[model samples]
Target: MCGSTVERFFRGISEFIFHTKLGVADVQLVDYVSDLMLRFVRVDSLYSLRQSDGMRTKHVVQMISEAERRIGLAKREVYRHVGDFTLFWSGMYPESLSAKKNRGESPDQLIDYCRQGKRAYAIAAEIEGGADRPSSELIHRMSEHFEMCAYGLREVRRHWEEDDDSNGLLTW
Candidate 1:
């Protein structure tokens, strides 16, 4: 699907699951999660952060390490990416964890995505401070309700899977 088509699809499903089904009325939270799904549709966006050698950082631990090595806005962005990465995987494609383990992917196999994701968001929120009040608040809400968001995404996955027309639209 094209960018606008994918965005519309995710936005519609996210609205249905989060607002109607889950009873979550936080519009910003719903929009953030939907935007996350839309962004992750592209393989490049899924692992957009690069390492020193120019490799896309694939592991949560590695991303965290990279985040720690930076400061200020860069650090905050990296931590935010870590949160987004963990949330996307654990919420949408949890079954892929075991596959990653079988492939000898490190750290993530032994760690909790929810924990890391929540902590990462918290750090991002703290780093945000008064410079961006709205963004910080949204990130704080994300940290406080990471599990709910993750559960909502899982519901989204289920909803799509059960739809007759879903077919290959969820290949990501």
Candidate 2:
């Protein structure tokens, strides 16, 4: 059942890429997201193994931990780029990037917001930690969120490509 679900998720992602106007930046983001998905699938599979054969559950746990580390790194990288671009596109200097316009707050004050996003990603990565009694609802929600991110990236790339084409800009 789990294997089939994973396969279906990958198929959906591929179909989305084929039907959407994916661009270089979007493709890059998709690659990162895809890597994360693959890692999750691996962790899930290992977890399933633990249920039928408890002998190697420890190994599965270790694998999940490693996958979590990788996911965390990827999340950090994504946020770093996203934050930089957010500041640039908004015409805000680095010092003012996190400032709250209405509240007159500094970027430091928004650290919790960033942490919340990263925590979501971290939780997704560790979704299989309790495989023996994993929450199916949570897994489904994570999968949906992953797909949404992929689709959003594709749309962003499509718009960027269109903008470049209209201006005769050589993105290559």
Candidate 3:
């Protein structure tokens, strides 16, 4: 495997932030909370790459696979920080969709372990229902996935603003 391809998600996120001026202005502030920010940024970048209009060459399949893989990995990392809604919907909003479960660590909490990367193909299976699903339906589900990711990014924005108390908003 190409080392650069293996690192595409992180590099893509940095590139996206640099080009779009969407990154935090001060390195110190962002680095102070790198653990919380990295997963949120990586997943957002992966999905943004997926929705890109770039022409698919022979290697495009790998990019899609990488996006799906990174999404799962990000979800897992986020799960370690908080239960429910690794991809969104469960805890991103002003209110919980249901009574909150026991609060896990919030994103601002620090950790020292590297998480395993994964793919969401099985998760997709749950949403897609079966192999015979129509192309349009799959496309719709993919779009929903993107929207949920946007919410996930928004949640990150909220956490950044209330770093010490992010769990308070999330626990609602």
Candidate 4:
């Protein structure tokens, strides 16, 4: 896709980790996850889903409720956003969730991120009518392999932490 240097950086690391270390050779999945990482690097992108009052939706339940109120591609995209949201947090920074829980700040304390993520992806994959089969199939595969992808993301975080040159790269 000839993205920016930052995107390329994420793609390179994601490819090496997901394909080589994690044995997930699906190029589409790797690309999707890499792009997701790239997108979520920004605080605004991480919480891009907004309410009618223009407030960012912080909780997954609220996101799901909003998704249910939509129709067509918009609904599908919101569901997909939910999946991405859950995966990004649960995979990349699970320890933060624990910390939040201990401090009584975990908004999703009673919710299961993995189950909701997989279900959201499945719902997203089922939407639309063959207008974009490739994306639908990719999202479907994401649902089927959600756990592996989440594990792969955890490994990605570990690999990045072990690398000394990755400092401040994701800040941009």
Candidate 5:
């Protein structure tokens, strides 16, 4: 049987079209909520979180896990610069990320956020490489994916700012 579109979106890099759809929206909300929930004292596993609409629960977990795995697979060893966009690998982050951690954000929080962005850029590059032929459209789509990762980063930044546990790390 064929994989779900969202699964293909994660696993089948070449064919993954970055469409603004229900999967993207739901994953954003779910991830954002998960980020927020993580700030609290941990009491349960992510899979144990209450499933209001239980139907898609398994799919959500599977999707995230697969994406994370794919991101790891797609991660690059050397820093790649595409035009003005400089993409960093998992262990190596950008200066902006360092500034965030230095300002007051928890290292863990910023690390996770950077990793997410890395995943986005890596997947975008993978798709572009797998394309039949290079086109401006492909570049545009990759840039859009990169921007989506930035958007997610901003969300996590806000979450970090609001946490009561944040001590001196509140330099805005």
Candidate 6:
């Protein structure tokens, strides 16, 4: 299969694993994806801007557009993964547990939720690596994805903190 297609397939598998009953393995996947997403965003931003400068002569506007699309798609995927993970964790605790009612679920449950989310992230990172065009298009998409991931991560972190401390910020 083509690199892009292969990447997509792997990404889908990762998403599946995250949504499934995977365990701590998913956390490792998320960490991997997070690092890759950051790297792709940085590299793609610089690359796309540089390539855009020569678009007049290279007539590569289409390429740039495609790259932007890829970035947008990737970003959305990452956001969804993070959001889902946050929600899952939030469901395990109370919005305002009294000291007597604050026992909450075990740490293992929280870890499992995080692991599944991370697995989904790993898939996205793998697909992001499929862009071999090395043009401005790829860079633009990476930058977009990076921004989305950043936002999603913050949201996820907030949810985790609120859930753990019964702050109600992440309550549904």
Please rank every candidate by lDDT, starting with the best. 1, 4, 2, 6, 5, 3
Sort the predicted structures by TM-score, highest score first. Answer: 4, 1, 5, 2, 6, 3
Q: Model 2: runs farther than 4 Å from truth?
A: 1-25, 44-115, 118-172
Q: Model 6, which residues run further than 4 Å from truth?
A: 1-24, 36-49, 54-156, 159-172
TM-score of each: 0.88, 0.24, 0.20, 0.89, 0.24, 0.21
**Can you write out model 5's per-residue Cα lDDT over 21-115, one digit (the tens) per residue?**
21354333233223323322132332232233442222222333334444322322111121112222121234554665587643333344434
| Number of clashes found in candidate 4 | 0
In candidate 1, which residue ranges exceed 4 Å CA deviation?
1-3, 102-104, 129-134, 165-172
lDDT of 1 by residue, 79-152 (tens): 88988898999899988977877777576778888899999999998886455433988998999999999999
Error of 4 at 69 (Å): 0.9
**Model 3 segments more than 4 A misplaced:** 1-61, 65-139, 142-148, 160-172
Q: Give the Å shift of residue 29 in candidate 2.
A: 0.4
List the global CA lDDT of all models.
0.88, 0.39, 0.33, 0.88, 0.34, 0.37
Candidate 2 local lDDT, 31-88, one digit each (tens): 4444344444454432332223333332222323333445444433333223222322
Candidate 1: residue pairs that collide: none
Per-candidate clashes, comma-separated: 0, 0, 0, 0, 1, 6
Tens-digit lDDT track for model 3 on 27-81?
A: 4222222323444445543233322455332122334344444444443322222
Clashing pairs in 6: 27-115, 30-118, 44-139, 48-136, 67-137, 71-141
In model 3, the number of clashes is 0
Superposition TM-score, candidate 4 onto the true structure: 0.89
In the range 1-172, model 4's lDDT, one tens digit per residue, is 6888888889998999998988887999999999899999898998999987889999898899999998988899999999999999889998876776678765777788899999999999998735554388899999999999989899988887767456744543
Clashing pairs in 2: none
lDDT minimum window of 10 residues, candidate 3: 109-118
RMSD of 6: 17.2
